[model samples]
Target: MIKKLIILAIIVVIAVFIRNSPYSEYLTFSYLEENSDALLAYVSDNRYISIISYVFVYIVVAGLNLPGAAVMSLSGGFLFGAGFGTAFAVTGATLGACIGFLVSRYLLGDVLNTKYEKQLAKFNKELAVNGYLYMLTLRLIPIFPFFVINIVAGLTKLRLFTFFWTSFIGMLPGGFVYVYAGSRLSNIESPKDIFSPGMISAFILFGLLMLVPVVYKKVKGRV
Candidate 1:
């Protein structure tokens, strides 16, 4: 517990520093536009440094559940291009999310489980049966904050490995979409344009297409 608190404190300190730094300002698309060459040169001249810096930034972002993840995603695209940026961002984000998950579990899961065990027993049983599917679904749709998913999921009956793999795979498509769009930042007007009604409608159609099998099963069940 003491060790966890210490780690959490360290993470918090780093987050605060990053929040105030110039990188935080550069995280915006407009700032990135104004400083792309310098940013790219820094990344190229210090490849090792860039990787370490990305991991640190991701840890701070996910650890604190900060609002700048989208900006970070864009910065990744600007610095590393689409392919490498997607890989780096996903890997760093996942690792950081896992850390946050462990911290939350260690701190709160026991107390909540112990207090609500009796009332939650039935829900736990259901979770044990379908937790992996739900995790994948949440990863795809992103109804909850990434850090929240990490912490709250630890309280469920899902296996850790199952959660990890599902999250990793399920996050890929969305990651690709965002990173690809980020790679085209010069063409974009605003971050809000990324999820305009048309894009959302397209994603909704794609989601429905993917759900056909489950819908079939449900309809058959009713018959």
Candidate 2:
């Protein structure tokens, strides 16, 4: 545990420094839009470099708890097309989430558990019993930030493999939706364009599609 904390401290320090650096600006949607052509060309010309770059960027974004991950997901689609982009997004996101979860768990989970043992008991119980369900719900609806979700989940008793695989599977539908939309880049002006009213409504509809199972389970339990 001490070793984990030391490693986590190093990661946090590095993440903080990177977040405050100029390169952080390049993580935004505007930067992505302005350099879309160049980014695409570069990725195409150097596939291996692109993979490493995406992994690094994704890890940093997750580690720092940044907010442009949706844009990055879309950008992946624009750069690599739907199939490869979805694959890239899922792998990178799962890896990033693992890194965030590890750091959060290593650095803070023990402290939180010790400080709020009684309060956290119920949560820990729920996580242990229904970990997969909770992860699926979050991945499907994304009612919270992915990195934040990962960090919070780390505070619970969810197994590492459970967290990893559930996050990967859960995020798939939305990842595919966004990436598919990105592949049809003609209508896209900016990342903002991706979240137009229609698209939001569609996302809501999709969320409802996912919520059906949850609602059914609730109703059945009540019966």
Per candidate, the number of residue pairs that clash is: 0, 0
Per-model TM-score versus the true fold = 0.79, 0.85
Candidate closest to the true structure, highest TM-score = 2
lDDT of 2 by residue, 84-113 (tens): 888888788888889878866778888876
**Per-candidate local distance difference test:** 0.72, 0.77
The candidate maximizing lDDT is: 2
True-vs-predicted CA distance for residue 57, candidate 2, Å: 1.9
Deviation from native of the Cα of residue 85 in model 2, angstroms: 0.8
* Model 1 whole-model lDDT (C-alpha atoms): 0.72
Deviation in Å, model 1, residue 201 alpha carbon: 5.0
For model 1, how does the per-residue alpha-carbon lDDT over 37-138 read when each residue is reduced to its tens digit?
887899989998997898678766766776677877777776788898888777777776777777666766777678867755765664564455556667
